[model samples]
Target: MSTAWAGGTDAILERMEQMTSLFVEETRKSMYKGESATHCEECGEEIPESRRLAIPCKYCVDCQTALEKGSK
Candidate 1:
């Protein structure tokens, strides 16, 4: 490989690393925190205890899926 091509590859890798770090920081800031709800806030369905223990979720699995789809 040419010397110039090697240098360009290193620059590209450094830029990719910077972009990945920024994305990780943003995702960390947006993650759910605090206590998990016992019931689905949207559908009023009872959220299972297992679900509550699994993650800090405010809605049931079904409702969460619908909300994600609608957002897109």
Candidate 2:
């Protein structure tokens, strides 16, 4: 009985973690939606047209890379 309860708790925790990740990702997307800037918000460098089209949000390539790295 104890083992069964522990397994069930573990499953619930795993599902909660997955849900939290999904929520964070969705929130990040929504925060950046409809945001387009010509320069990197972090370093004030000019953002390329290709990257602007690709990302459609703030931050240049280098800044974006750093931001992602820091997030991880």
Predicted structure with the largest lDDT when compared to the true one: 2
Indicate the residue-level lDDT of 38 in model 1.
Answer: 87
Provide TM-scores for the models: 0.60, 0.70
Tens digits of per-residue lDDT, candidate 1, 1-72, equal: 567786589789999999999998878556666788888999899999999998878899999899879962
Residue 44 displacement in candidate 1 (angstroms): 1.1
lDDT (0 to 1) per candidate = 0.85, 0.86
Best by TM-score: 2
Model 1 misplacement above 4 A:
1-29
